[model samples]
Target: DQQVKQNSPSLSVQEGRISILNCDYTNSMFDYFLWYKKYPAEGPTFLISISSIKDKNEDGRFTVFLNKSAKHLSLHIVPSQPGDSAVYFCAASVIFSSGSARQLTFGSGTQLTVLP
Candidate 1:
């Protein structure tokens, strides 16, 4: 069973518009949620993140909202630009122990296309 799921395989948006991506997770132990953006032939880079204690987090044009009770999360991009076109992935991690590395579980991914 997948702990994290991105139901949408892709999304499209016009430049300077908003793009929304959704995610769902099955694990309650997840304390941290993250979004990553990846381009072809490159590694996924960190985008935004939210802690379980907070309902939302924002960084410039990107924002992430978490609803623990519903086990759902969404990422919003405001004024989406052409450069923002890429594969977006939702990831969740639980802290197993102090001083231990976090193991992240990632959703498949959602490809975002920004049309000019």
Candidate 2:
């Protein structure tokens, strides 16, 4: 049972357009969510994140929104550029009482292609 799901395997966006990537989770215990972007050869880098207590978080051109009731979340990028093309992964975590301890579950990545 995959806890986190990204139904769309891929998405294509033109430059200067907005790109939206969707994700869903089945586990209600998940308290925090994060998005990671990976280039062709490099490791996945942290993009943006949102906690269950908050609905949205923004970092420059990237924004992450969480809908706890629907168990859904999304990553939005404005003015999408070709350089932004990469595989994005959605990760959910259940924070434990052990301070930094957490159980993380990752969704299959969705490939994003940005056209110039």
Candidate 3:
């Protein structure tokens, strides 16, 4: 079973507009979440993240929000630019009692396109 899922396979936004990407998870055990942006010839790069304890986390133009009660999270990019177009992956992980984190479970990525 896919614990994490990005229901929308793709999203399109105009340059300088806000783009929102959403994700859902079935596993409540997950305590941490992250978003990764991947380009055609490069590996997925860490974009933003949030802890289950916090509802929102922001870094520059990227913001991640988590709704623990709903098992959902979303990434919002403001003033979307062409360079921001890429596949965005949502990943979740659980932290063990030993303070170590387990391997992340990733959702199928959502392709984001920014039109000029």
TM-score of each: 0.95, 0.94, 0.94
For residue 20, model 2's alpha carbon misses the true position, in angstroms, by: 0.2
- The C-alpha lDDT values of all candidates are 0.96, 0.94, 0.95
What tens-digit string does per-residue lDDT give for candidate 2 at 52-72? 999999999999999999999
Query: What lDDT tens digits, residue by residue, belong to model 3 across residues 1-116?
Result: 99999999999999999999999999898989999999999999999999999999999999999999999999999989999999999999986657775779999999999999
Q: Which stretches of candidate 3 lie over 4 Å from their true place?
A: 95-101
Worst-scoring 10-residue span by lDDT in model 3: 94-103
- Runs in model 2 lying further than 4 Å from the true structure: 96-100
Where does candidate 1 stray beyond 4 Å?
A: 96-99
lDDT of 1 by residue, 1-116 (tens): 99999999999999999999999999999999999999999999999999999999999999999998999999999999999999999999987567488989999999999999
Q: Which candidate number has the best lDDT?
A: 1
Q: How many backbone collisions does model 2 have?
A: 0
Candidate that scores best on TM-score: 1
Steric overlap count per candidate: 0, 0, 0
lDDT-superior candidate, 1 or 2: 1
